[model samples]
Target: MRITNRMLSNNAIRNINRNLENMARAQEQMSSGKRVNRPSDDPIVVARILAFKTSIAANDQYQKNMEDAKGWVDASESALGMATSTLQRARELAVYGANGTMPKESMQALGKEVDQLIDEMKQIANTSYGGRYLFGGSRTTEAPFVDNTGNDKNVKPVIYNGNEANLEWEIAPQVKITVNENGQQIFVDAIDTNTGNKIGIFDLLKKLSNALNSGDYSGVEDTLSQFDQAIDHILDIRASLGAMSNRLEMSLSRLGDTQISLTQTMSKLEDVDLAKATIEYKNYENVYLASLATSAKALQPSLIDYLS
Candidate 1:
């Protein structure tokens, strides 16, 4: 092999550039605090990091869904609880109105109070959370119960405007749960077997109020059993809401655990050790300097250099 100054200088330059590239990589790792700055750095690790990040993002979405479901269930439970209390009050009023000896004026006053309670029950049935009705099934924007009775006594006092569709939320991968109860089911399905008419809580309240105002003691007495049935229905719905809330809480806990694990795994794959990166950079810099020094001594000076 013909050894020459040109060859020696070229080799030295190439070695120096390689060392500079190594040092630059180490410096980048230190500055960015990441081992894989680009895909070329470590393709396998980069792929793994991307997969983990996608999983983490999905977990976050599931957690959010569970939170939304929890809010809906909580609001529904609170509303149902209020409904039960309101029904109990109506039942007490019915008991009082059933006494035939009560004066007509006293019965009419009690009927007025019962009417007010009916309005309160409507409010409870149309309860909302975050501007969406909780008991309206999938029809969340509209009130579930409305006062349709005006001068026409033939029509039912309360009309249900919601549907029977169940609203579901995905709290985990491939796992969905119902978060809403059908308002129609809860408020409009109870039938008065005696009269062969649907006498759900609202209608039951209406009949009781009409009986008291008209001094019909028998009609008021008839409502006591219906009120009991309505209260029981509301309690059953509330129990289901409680179960849904528990499931949502469990889903949230699982999502939190999965998120932590994904983050740790991602950190292991991509995060750089600052101390190790710094040491590697220093080593590369020292080797580059040493190579430069040796090249200066070994490569003979050109004649043009001396003339200059």
Candidate 2:
């Protein structure tokens, strides 16, 4: 079949347009450094990128939760340490007060110091971080311990108003971690197994203070025993807080690894191979230039060249 001049010109124009379009697309890919600029470029790859983005966002939130948990754990550990020291001081005073040879004035002086320690303990119990109580459990907005009356009868008197609720945060899908501990259970004494009566650190301190003021050396021995038990209770809570800190650190490390892996996967799915893309872009550019040159030659008119 013989081809007409108009048909030849039309075919040449079509070829030039197709080559130019390819060159433009290649340039765009190279400039953006992405394999797929739009979903239409590769629907499957686009979907995968979307999923990776979601995973990254979720991981970021988990990391933030881990940070907040770490802060809370640190605060708890510090407060517990202070309480332990205060209890040890109180124990020493109790032992001194137990001696009958000590004068009444000396015992009163010791009582004053005990009163100071009690104040310090109350301060620790009411410790707050970022305007929220560290030992308040779920009642973070309010003080954990409140002194209803200011009298000496209520001097060491403080009530644990916090609940037993454990504050929790979700670190990942189906994974939750307790970020806050219940102050009532940890700082207060366990309910007596025999009598079912509740006792706490404050209750023991109150008894000790009363015994010292009344010059009752007989009750001093039992009060010292209770003080020892309170120390042990606080130590156990500190151990638990330390364990929680360790867990959060491990979780943070794992999350860092996960984020690294996700970033690599996202790069593989979306990032352009610079070396290969450069070569492809060059090839497209050559084709575009050749098509333009050919079209220019086809559009030119020469009678001698046509005859030849």
Maximum-TM-score candidate? 1
Error of 1 at 67 (Å): 0.6
Best by lDDT: 1
What's the TM-score of each model vs. the native? 0.93, 0.90
Report the C-alpha lDDT of model 2 over 89-204, residue by residue, as the tens digit: 99999999999998888888888888788789889988887788987888999988887475644534877888888888887888998877677886665323236766777767
In the range 147-202, model 1's lDDT, one tens digit per residue, is 78567442368888889998988877788988888878888886456667666778
Q: Which segments of candidate 1 are over 4 A away from where they belong?
A: 149-155, 195-197, 302-308
* Each prediction's whole-model lDDT (CA): 0.87, 0.84
Off by over 4 Å in 2: 150-156, 190-196, 302-308
Q: For each candidate, C-alpha RMSD in Å?
A: 2.0, 3.1
Candidate 1 TM-score over all chains jointly:
0.93
Worst 10 residues of 2 by lDDT: 186-195
